[model samples]
Target: MSDNQPSPDTILRLINGYWSTGILGAAAAHDLFTHLEAGADSAAQLARRAQISERGAQTLLDGLVSVGLIDLAGGRYRNTAAASQYLVAGRPADLSALARLKLTHMGNLTALPEVVRAGGPVTDAAVEVADNPHWGQVVPAIAAQSVPAAAVAADVLQLERAGEISILDVGGGSGIYSATWLERNPAARATQLDWEPINAIARRLLAERGLADRFTCIDGDFHTTDFGTGTYDIALYSHIAHQEGPEDNIAVFTRLKDALKPGGALLVVDYVVDDDRAGPAFPLLFASEMLLKSKQGGTWRRADYHAWLTKAGFSDVSFHAAPPATLVIAR
Candidate 1:
């Protein structure tokens, strides 16, 4: 390469620097986009609204403007199109809560050094020390995101004719999957199995959705729990399989198959990696985060899921895309 040209690796690293996250988090914490939704404001105005020092607001706003998250005209800052659409509070596409969750709870990026030193999955020591209900507290937030996925999965699973149908939601935090399905199909009943603390959250969520009458929350570990045999018309294994290794995932699927009627369907929703394991940066990056936090959690390819489903005695295994992630349906 010529002296004037930057190396591809160097360019990539520069583009993906940690500063991006800091800037995004700062913008979210200040609610900068929300304030700018109506119109632009000067740094002093923004500082007053955000209750931060003028200098601090100016510095953060400058960075945001540089990153194209905000626009500056006549020394007043306004949200960029992308920020206005996705970062502003009260908007349909708002992802501010998700951003805040990442910044406050996950803390994966900040724990990288310790994770590397330990050569193992990083535990949330702060939460553990405080006896914090990490999974319980996050269940509501997870359920909010899962609502759409559940609806899509239910549609694809085709659980319409319901007559005392049994449905198992393995690792189904907050009972979103079962709640959604039960809400649509009144005659169907569901069993949501998850950690004890998370089961409390699931109960609360089901009650909130007026689904408590049709859904039962079971507090237990799926790995050790007996999911029963040939009882369910539909089994949903959404967003939990990737947190395990292939062997464990296959075992879970096999168990799910045994729990389902001969013609019943198993619905799985997760980030499915392409065969090459290249591009689609979000899923791959999520897999890395899983690696950093779990003993054997990572994203899997569609082919891998299909193969496992077939081996688990489910024929007609297939994959369907649900916007960001893929849904694997088998019967």
Candidate 2:
């Protein structure tokens, strides 16, 4: 076989992808990262702490090291910086729950062929449901991942200098954006629009962060819920676009634009594909998840967003790279 010819390596890696998720999920389920962070340095120690066999602990530790999530030295195991920061339980930005959530949702991906044939989620309320219990577990877990993006958005918009701004956070899961903005600017207040259950979660989280006074929530679907016109200085439509069809996105965006005060900014953050739809690997693959989870949803291209924002009555639009996601700003 020539070097130019195709290789089975990529295909094999794709076929074996679940092995990585399984290993990571098992570690998370066993709280291995938490144990390691708490000084379970050896396989024997980990087994005792995590209540697994020493052999099993050793194998799992080796697998974690192979996956670059753990480090081994002098026969002692420890979490890598990334794992320590994001996977260890009780860390400020802990994503252990998100790991578990992804593993739980893996079953949805297995039915991709059926979803493709049916053109949407074949299961009852797999993802696009308003009051689905999955949102309860999902919203909080995914919030940690948005911490960096939210902070960046706050900075990019100069919320600290803007002074006395009102924000509308549409589909504001966990209220991270509101929390971030309120923390940055003492005069900033926000209202999140989401389901009642989700709003309850956001309320509790914001209160826990001592932001309840500045962060309020309204329980309603963004599809039909009225976004009061000229009410907010900034409007945020984050992450929800991927689950919506093009028409729904346009309609909601129009509402968001109308909700913003004159000269106010509308920020949309999501997994946006390049216009050619060829690369930026994650967003392209994420479209598959939308297929499994939504009726008419997929990752969209820059051109699609530009057109939608223009049609939504925004006079200007700009895209910002936030890494692992993108932000589209319109005014």
Candidate 3:
């Protein structure tokens, strides 16, 4: 192929991209980055440190080097700057859990052929509040990684300085948004409505932030929970809508509107595609992720959200671009 255009085989290369994913997963599983950080540079040294065979270590490290995940010079391997920052054990943005989460998605992705043929998701499993077995691991894992993004969202929301504003954090995991908002609006207080174990985590995080007295944690399912009418100044539905389909989202937004005071607003943060659904990449991949885990959920377009929010009786609905997702606010 000439430099002016890419080769058709590029699509085949992209389709078989699991080679890269597998390399990262195996490295994370064996604590390869951590070992490298601790001064194991040679393949034999890393192998002995990880208690694996030299040949296996050489193959893994070579692949990582080829992928730019690591650097090899003079027969010594080292984590690239990006890898050191995100893959190492102690780095603040350490995404080892996210890496493992991607590996978990492999099973669902492998079933895509069957899922499409059967005209339904192969697995309908999703995280739930009642009698949940995955929340203990899943909630914290997701919340820890996602809370920073929520902080970025808080900036975009630019919450008013009005004191005594009450917010209801729907499906709020660790109450990070509330904490962030409370930090900005000193007089504002929040009520977190989420599942049992996740609510417990929220309470702890709020207390740690010294905002426990300003916040309340309520453990219940979002669908069945009774949100007292006209009780809240604002309701934050961050990252929760993508788990529900068209009808469910419409119904939930209606409930949320009722839960709000007459002039109150509802804020929704979710992965949303444009009208054409062509791609911003993340939302598209997330659509597939939802298909793997959810029975009736996928990323929606902004137009979909606007239509549903309007049908739910919310006016002044608008969508704004946010990293990896879009923000919808309606009153």
Candidate 4:
């Protein structure tokens, strides 16, 4: 083949990608990174700590080292900077919990081929964090993962100028956005609605930041919950629309529009696709991931959002700047 001809390197790399994912998943499953942080560096030491065979431990550690997830020097292993920041448990930004979730949901991907063929998820929907013990890590990790994004939300929303704003944070999760907004606008208060597990997490997170006094937690599913008509100055739906199909999102926007006082704004942050539905790779891929997770959820286009919001009686729907996702504000 000529040098101009394409090679199979990329294809082979994609095929072998799961090898590293499995390595990291195994590490998280056994709490291997945290154990290393606790000073169990040698394979034998890590093996004893994790209750695995020495050979298994050595192979796992070596694979991690080769991937730059961990470093090995003088026959001892340690976490690399990236691993230390994201794979070690107990840190605020640690993603070990997501890794554990990947391990727990290993079987969740078995239906993917069928799902793709059928154009929808084929597996039975599982219980949420409220009922799943395996999601204990995932619950808090969701909150931790949103911290920086929440900070960005605060800036983009211009909470400082939303004087004495009353925000209804729908499907607020751990209330990271609420807390961030409160930090930016001490004069504002928020009502956070989510499941029991998330509300419980939110209470503690807000309390720790001394913002508890600025927020109230309401426990229930956002789809079924009563939003109290005309009760809020702003309604926020962050990273939530992609989890619902267009019709459900339209209903959600309608309800949120009713919840807001006249002239109040409704903000939606989501992975929105361009009108052509081509490229903008992240949103396109997120659509597949959402499809895998839910029977109906997938990324929608900006025009889709505008039409839904407008159909919901929201006038003047417009886009605003928010990194890593599209932000739409309607009044």
Q: Give the winner by lDDT.
A: 2
lDDT of each: 0.78, 0.89, 0.82, 0.82
TM-score of each predicted structure versus truth: 0.80, 0.93, 0.82, 0.80
For model 2, where is the 10-residue window of minimal lDDT?
Answer: 123-132
lDDT tens per residue, model 4, 1-331: 8999999977886677677778888888888999999999899999999999899889889889867898888877899887887778887667776776666666666778888998887766675445566444566666656665666667766889878989999888777788878988999999999888777888898999899888998988898999999999989998889978889999999999999998889989888888999847778877767767777888989899999999999889887654457778899
> Which segments of candidate 1 are over 4 A away from where they belong?
1-4, 7-16, 37-46, 54-94, 105-119, 122-132, 158-165
Best by TM-score: 2
Q: Would you list the rank order by lDDT, best first?
A: 2, 4, 3, 1
> By the lDDT metric, which is better: model 2 or model 4?
2
Question: Which portions of model 4 show Cα errors greater than 4 Å?
Answer: 26-92, 126-135, 320-323
- The local distance difference test score of model 2 is 0.89
C-alpha root-mean-square deviation, each candidate:
4.0, 2.0, 3.4, 3.8
Residue 317 CA displacement from its true place in model 1, Å: 1.1
List, residue by residue over 1-331, the lDDT tens digit for candidate 1. 9999877986764667656667777778788788778654877887788888889888888888877888887767788787877788766446676666666643456676777677656675543221356765466555556656776877776666565688888888778778778887888999988777877888887798788888887777788899899888888888887878898999999999999987888888998899999846778877766667677778898789989899988888888877577888899
lDDT value, candidate 1, whole model = 0.78
lDDT measured at residue 256 in model 1 versus the true structure, 0 to 100:
92
